[model samples]
Target: MVLGRQRRQIMKILIAIDSFKGSLSSKEAGEAIKSGILRVIPDAEVLISPLADGGEGTVETLVEALGGSLETVRVKGPLFQEAEAHYGILSDSQYSPKDEKLAVMEMSQASGITLVSPEERNPLKTGSYGVGEMILDAYHKGCRRFLIGIGGSATNDGGIGMLSALGFRFSKENGEEISPIGEGLKDLAGIENASVPEGLLQCSFQIACDVENPLYGENGASLIYGFQKGGNKELLSQMDLWMKHYSELVKEYNPAANPEAPGSGAAGGLGFAFRSFLQGELKSGVSLILEETKLSKKMQGADLVITGEGRLDEQSAMGKAPIGVAKLAKTQGIPVIAFAGTVTEGAKACNQAGIDAYFPILREITTLEDAMNKETAKQNLADTVEQAIRLYRLQHKKQ
Candidate 1:
């Protein structure tokens, strides 16, 4: 494998890869890819740009990319248990006023499915109150603009839990206050928001969402995602009906709440909550992250852009971070290559999404458990990247 003159010419390469869940972080994966590129071309100029798609690593990715600090606070967990949650705050200098701080939050930190045990994965019992706590924590720290990634939720509460944390009240028909949870939605007869934190009204929110499911229906939150949160047939039906009822009640309080709005079903109705209560604007996660990372500026004179995720499959073609990066690079006529932990069926769809080529980072045949081992994944990622770059050079030399 040799590049010779080609290797010297192709000096600038950018790596903006997503985290490999349960394995490497976005920064770690980018470093591994960089190590591989360095192995093939020792002097190649490599830039490591960590990324995420509004999922687990979103807060960290944006913080790292924009040079921010993470603030951790004790917040209510999905099951109403105490848990430590993290939100990122970019320094004032990173924003326009140079004194205004920006907060980046991933809802998963406070109300994600991973917080619950398999045996206790009941959505009816989960609450997004913790997510609200996280936001308030950031607000107290002087963040007025929030970029929230709402994904991987465990609750089916239609934002009432979150609103509750912010001082909103849900009342029973008899004028009794009820704690907001999936099961409590049916008892909510009235909403009181006059007591909500004053700061909340001044803050702006932007939600990163990827789905377009409405608030309640066959494709909605309860029916489509409740089962994953431990809802059975009967429970799902009840949950769906409750969501419909809750959405209507919310509409009475806020006319802007349209349950038929796209992405209203995301994060179990947290998207609906943000959209209706906070007036948050929904945008694709990858597109938001790329703009935050300034990929357009980074791609200006790059010879190649490399990106990857935990897996490359049909899903990768559906607005995932790697494909989003590839499309951005393609617009500038920059070649984009991706490396994934494994290539599964339907990965060919990535070709149509603007990825010039992709490679699987597997050293040898191995079981799923072995392939996911931290050391094994790191080394394989490096080796596959090294070989792929060599092959790319080899192919280019012929042309």
Candidate 2:
């Protein structure tokens, strides 16, 4: 019925778009969209809520959404070196109680592949010890609810390093404690859980994940994602076997651990560690972000919602932010449109995924390198959005 209303009566528009990755930040992208909407209807009430799917921009997006600040902490890096990592804490929010602080973290900050040099990117050498430290840092600051994005990793340690940081020690058959890493898993004779941080069990974690790879196998972490982290074919085979051994050992410590579940292979097996050890729940990243940001409430009485990402493709339907936003708006009977830096081959699928229509930001054929230039991306995004809105208004002209 809302869609049936006249264009003059539909004043509010919601813009919940993710970052353009290399070109624009979430806030910047949202601003571009807002500018576009304002160009068509200068007095329109456009609400811009920048978003991310628990990935690199998660902290900034959530902090901006919930009115919080980023807190920096010193933590161990993937290579056992000192590293600085940041997490966002929602000190206050319109939705959350003042007493409760929600933390959003991205594991890639401290243990991402980009942090390591290409030559030193061996999965066997890197670890996720820093990720656990980030959690502890947030926990010490009184954050009990964690929204974690577990994408972009530099290790295949099966999360041994993270578990070690949280008080689970890996010992060899000789009772000697060993440093946790992918190769070190071969010596994982036993695990000591007595030293795990106290009150850790009281915390709850919601992992933002999109993949469904299991812990170890052809489709698992090592086989699928390890090569990008410097694992050769031979190293991948070895790491896979070690991961199997590590999972078996972990099962001995926690009988309920299920490493084969969907998303268990994410971030070099950090998904398994969180699910099996920390008792975390894995969910679609954009969905979690939507709930945290109270998108539905913000969208109330809106005539249209616009969302976008760096690209639109078949993968957009696989838990991408735009499609997620579209699906939410669909439930409210609101029409949704998306704009992307480039509309790829499979982008037509978005129509079936709840998006009423979509458009590409680029106005002319150009190299990806050229299209991603910050100024170019911004102008293209704004121009495309303006034209799209003009077309939308034309379609709804007095019948």
Candidate 3:
């Protein structure tokens, strides 16, 4: 007589996907995958963790994942005009101590190139003062830990604009205060921090930076990025010279300054300023997000792991968010499957990078606009995931 098969244990699945960019958010993508999984296994356990690459959607992804709140403040814009910016505050017990709060922000929200119209975009006239104001606002709200994504800036000021707002004064040879714009860097002769807030000293900063350009030279901020910020050849040359002078001054003031360090030129030298003055640590954006989300811990006991983003290509295999998640899941011997809106031939690299298999969610040929429609993307993602999970169940049943 054939023995009765033993009952199977409930399947546990962990989903951590990045935003679809102009389509679905990270949270929404995870929910869609969860819906698909539930359809396949009614009693399966599913955990959703939203993630970002420390770029555009970082604040929203972190806020949702950590159960945090958002705070908005009006601050100086790239051109020193009043601009509204929003940041996330995390008080979750899992991520922070009861008395400690963490603030997550993107510099683009305040000093981004998008804030300045193309005709008005000029690195010489732009500043990062708004970024500093945002930090101060969060500090006053009891936040001492900062996770800042410094990308898409409009200034080439060597971060003096942000420093000025943070109570660090920059002066010319005559000791007159210098304007906190890129042009001001040309005449800068002195740096003073006597007025810096005491609380700021106790704060710690983690900067999300992926670029490796130094403070000045060919690959520096001004020479490489200034042109995109509306700088002409002549202006970028001048700005690069000013950046060199500013780095020298910073080195003199902070003996430990490393102007040539990787990422020191990120965000028009805001990376240098953060490293030199605020003691911020620059790190890989995707790696930082993975650590903060506690993805490793969450993967524990998970029978399978699912991760993906808007697109899967060679770049995704080269340390993008989805591959980051897959690598971590691999460390624990969990199988990882990924789903994307579109898949390119280069995406085959993802298989070697820890994604056991990947599937494109698009069902039929359609216009980009229709594919990206919110409702349409959601339905497509749910349907694709459901089929994948059904196949997953069939494989398990054979065992």
Best model number under lDDT: 3
Return model 2's CA RMSD, one decimal.
3.3
Where's the lowest-lDDT run of ten residues in candidate 2? Answer: 91-100
Compared with the true structure, model 3 gives a TM-score of 0.96
Worst 10 residues of 1 by lDDT: 91-100
Where in model 2 is the C-alpha error above 4 Å? 1-10, 95-98, 363-380, 397-399
lDDT of 3 by residue, 201-276 (tens): 7798999999999999999999999999999989899899999999899989999999899999999999999999
* Per-residue lDDT of 226 in model 1: 93
Q: Return the TM-score for candidate 1, rounded to 2 decimals.
A: 0.87
Q: Candidate 1 residues 1-399, lDDT tens each? A: 366766557679999999899888898899999999999888888998768988778887777766799999999998999999999998646342447778899998999899999899998889999998999898888898888998889999988889899988999999998778888897989988888888787788879998899999999999999999999989999889989998989989998799999999998998898988888989998988887667789778888899989999998998899999999998999999999998887999999999988989888888989999988999999999999999877776787
- What digit string (tens of lDDT, one per residue) describes model 2 on residues 194-300? 99777887787899998899999999999999999998998899889988988998899899998899999999999999999889999988888998888999988
Each candidate's lDDT (Cα)?
0.88, 0.87, 0.93
Q: What's the distance in Å from true for residue 116, model 3?
A: 0.9
Q: Candidate 1 vs candidate 2: which has greater lDDT?
A: 1
Return whichever of 1 and 3 wins on TM-score: 3
Identify the superior model by TM-score, candidate 1 or candidate 2. Answer: 2
Q: Rank by lDDT, highest first.
A: 3, 1, 2
